[model samples]
Target: MDSRIKMENSMNMIFFGPVSSFMRIDAESLLHILTFTKKHLIPISRTILIWDLITDGKTAAFLYSREYLALGPLLNFVPEEDLYYVNFGDKSVLSFFANHNLGLHSRKYGILAASYRRYYGDMWYEDSDYINELGYLICGFPAHIISKITPAVFKKIDVEIFKKLSLCSVNQTKTLYNLATHKNAYGKPYKWSSHEITKLDILFICVPKESISSIRLEAIPAISKHIMEMIHQDKLEYFTKQQILRMNPEARRMYIIRVQLRTSLDTSQIAKQDANAIKKSVPLALIYVFTLILK
Candidate 1:
């Protein structure tokens, strides 16, 4: 480590840039700087994207993780590919990534890659975005991993992603249901709302019997047209037949009736189109048959 770099008074203003330039002149100096760098002195808000410069991302990440991790989300500086070199086996490292406000555009890219790379346990997430990312995954993520994801993600999650993920265990789904309808932003318990229950999309399939019993039967239709539009898409994301059977009787009945009505409308339109095609085909068929007989 060089004595010239020891000036700590200007770390926030002059640290990373001069250090970067000096590192280029003598690459070994960068490692020394990273080794001796004070964890608290690094400025988190500045827009410098120095993370890509480290050829040895793993060693560099291990040494300077405290200072540079927020750079990943803040600058989108560390791509998921770069993070592959850095080990996140430490729970604090992984948790730090979640607790930070996300700057990564997609939930699947860096966040998903981090969780997917690890085995389940010590798993939990503070950012609601992680839940949004996990919901859309094409492959299996451990159901238990959902134990800690912010339930707020469910309210804003793309209904399509919500539909694709019906992988919760009964207890996990119940937990999501509990937190979503009966909890506040701080994860404190709140009174559950039957109307709020309708907003959970595919999670509606696994509603606990107690919740179903609580839903106001007459009010089910009043859950709002916009909300229904989100839930009752033409494409099925979750298997509704058996999966939905366990839903509260009132909610289940409403879901079935809506689905049946949608199917009936679709079938009737197709039937009319087929009837018109049959009328046009009859004349062609007769002429073809007559030609065949004459031949």
Candidate 2:
């Protein structure tokens, strides 16, 4: 989609100040403001209030602990607790907007808009005292969840594999879907470690329009290679490279199978190829291929 369309589809809200400006508001005050707004003023289907504490790590932690529990479930559009530790930096906030939009459109609306944007200027945070009040105003608006992905990670993915994985929200119920087909195409079932799944989720969540479109046009094969490697290595089990090599292939394979079935998309052509290439070299590869073909 074009930039304008993407920006329009993004989480709809206006920030009133710099990220640092919200540090003064304590957790209770923030919760009070959100509670009041939810009970009365804002007229939206759902409201999600996020604090932009920026570099005020101390305050951010305190507010997150105290206010989040009280206000999170009350809002219809809150992010899952597991996914709430994101920073309030400019890029992160923008990513949040993108993710919220994607969640709303893909899982919620079936159709997705082309692009999304965040609008803020230097003067945006002029009203420091009323930051919580402003949050209330912006709360409960439907948003897609977007997670940030690093350039290095982005570089490792295959373009076509990325597209297939990027097919928005696939029906979780479809037993044999695009993901399965992707696994089959490479001649084996794709696998991922827990950490890899978390990273993939972040990638899917924060993928930019330019990055998505660019990957579609120029990087499919490379992306595929990286995804395969990640699966073969079971990058999800451990966050570091060293730990991946030590993981049992069977355990890694099971994790990949579960993730593939859950998200309903095959995310790594590299893994499949690795499995096939090592079929004769490794007994586990043979078992993985056999299990996939039988499935």
Candidate 3:
């Protein structure tokens, strides 16, 4: 059979077949298997395949044991909020903690819910669940990781605001972050959420500004921190102020590529005449790695 036809058949199986067939497969092996089989699947297909595995209990458990979900394997593909809810489900406290100990890093909601239950014994699970879902809306901390939060704290949370932030409707996070960090009319700190910065820390690192326009300006600090460090350390080529502004998106992409590859492939080394060829070739290579893996 033609290679293209064979690839199509493999994809059909992944999309149409039951996920249980892939349950025992761990994350690393699954990634290799998919990439090896077709080697050219599209991003959408890759996203779907990953979604299938993570949402399925048995398959997610297998992969979670290997601690691969937060490893950039599905970076930018899965929505950060949904991943937490899907993975947490309604499992017992012990099961939740067992999965948490696997070194899975992201998913603030899951971590918050588990921590809350660990200390409080589900006395206010509904409150925790609500706050967990609400945390997905704001850019910073989900709910403060407080040892003792008053009942008023739950009442003070605005469900409408949570919906706006969660849905990402019209500059919600940008506005919220600004207000949360600013002081009130009395010049005292305006407490927005909880005290922990873990969720916000992860959000600052993982969110892609180029892809999501609402937080482009807000994410500048996050994006610039890494890129500036790279240039200062001589990992990337230096650029003028105007050049850096224009190259923000490309710079961010390069940052992710660098983190993923962990190698120094300086663009400055590629000759000007061959630069265009390399620029086009990079996407083709990524499409293969991302989309066309085997079952």
Each candidate's TM vs. the true structure? 0.31, 0.22, 0.26
Which candidate achieves the best lDDT against the true structure? Answer: 1
- Please identify model 3 stretches exceeding 4 Å from their true place: 1-28, 31-42, 50-85, 89-137, 140-170, 177-295
Task: Give the lowest summed-lDDT range of ten residues in model 3.
Answer: 185-194
lDDT of 2 at 140: 24
Cα lDDT tens digits, model 2, 76-123, are 343333223323333443333333322232322211111111223223
| lDDT (C-alpha) at residue 59 in model 2 | 30
Pick by lDDT: 2 or 3, better one:
3
* Superposed Cα deviation of residue 224, candidate 2 (Å): 14
Question: Which candidate comes out best when scored by TM-score?
Answer: 1
Best-to-worst ranking by lDDT: 1, 3, 2
lDDT of each: 0.44, 0.32, 0.39
Overall local distance difference test of candidate 1:
0.44
CA lDDT for candidate 2:
0.32
lDDT at 89, model 3: 40
Q: Which ten residues in a row have the lowest lDDT in candidate 2?
A: 108-117
